[model samples]
Target: MADAREPVVVIGLGRFGTALALELAERGHEVLAVDRSDARVQALSGQLTQVVAADSTDIDALRQLGVQDFYRAVVAIGSELEPSILTTSLLVELEIEDIWAKAVSDHHGRILRRIGAHHVVFPEHEMGERVAHLLSGQLLDYMPIDTDFALAKIRPPHSAVGVPLAESRLRSRHGVTAVAVKREDGSFTYAGQDTVLSHDDTILIVGREADIERLVTRS
Candidate 1:
């Protein structure tokens, strides 16, 4: 077992996995990049701390490489359900403290969580929503608070500009609340009932997704 201080083990050398490993290694982490393909491992060998071509589903292979000693493990094989799940299970059995898995679908995400993955990310679905928000014109950024609620940074609609939160009745009429005002000058102000909105300012709003869509549509 190599010294395991501040180490991260990354399984799968696909685009997402390779990029993650590179970034972690760049941030001064001891990254062990694992993949079943020798070509994939060789491609990244010069960039990361270590690269190994080994099947992660094999528990003995993982044990030999001291996979359990790493503080975090990332299973980035989204499409390969079998290898991904098996690798996650092996990591769990080895008692890796933190496991982050990339999941292809909602069902896949649930299974990852059920098998002791600390977090599961749905990349394609999340990217689609983000792109939609960017194309919508009014919303600058969108972050999901829950299945039904979101936090949005948006440009104030023409109808909303020069209006105070009290008159806008955003909370009552739209079921949205202004959290903060980010001015064009790159300063932020805490929002209050009396805070007036401006066309140039970006406002952070928290509300149900439907209410947020309504606010944007009103623009």
Candidate 2:
């Protein structure tokens, strides 16, 4: 198993890369931020374990900076296709166990995976989708667990209000499971079959993405 304390190397220093590196550092992970721009490196200096101005695509420079020693790497070079692919390939060649790459599109994502990136993220695209879902105003929050499944936070539907979950038949009716509920007290509690739901209560539901969407958009 990979140690959580293991140092991670992040390349690019762009908006996505900088945010990821800082978040990782905030979570107590040792991070090395690398970018070719001296200004970017200088801006992040003293904020991370290490920040260096170096071309990530250059294998010699990467080796000199001891990047091969890190077990994980995230290639976050957005808008630059060649550097992103080259950097990811070099990390794979360096035998990094975990490689996460940011892709601007499906083709770019395929290339990253083909070059041995263990994980690929589309931050811009995903955020757009999440924002579109939130625009409906039916859900307070939405998290996709996988391609087909999701968890959503929403107010109890009219049929579900003033009834216990067991009698509400929410699962049978809407094909969604209410896992937890947050009441007027601003505290969350586990919701069982006998838990009664009120109009003001917020419910955390889990189910197939289609089912959750149907439940929220239902009349």
Q: What is the C-alpha lDDT of each candidate?
A: 0.88, 0.91
Give the total clashing residue pairs for model 1: 0
Candidate 1, residues 77-161: lDDT per residue as tens digits? Answer: 9989999999999999999988999999989999999999998987778778877877987788998777789999898767667
Task: Give the residue spans of candidate 1 off by over 4 A.
Answer: 1-6, 185-194
> If scored against the real structure, what TM-score would every candidate get?
0.84, 0.95
What would the per-residue lDDT of candidate 2 be over residues 1-219, giving only the tens digit for each residue? 689878899999999999999999999999999999999998899788699999999999999999999899999898999999999999999999999999999999999999899999999987887787889988899887777888888999888988889998888999999999999878989999889988889999999988988988982
Pairs with steric clashes in candidate 1: none
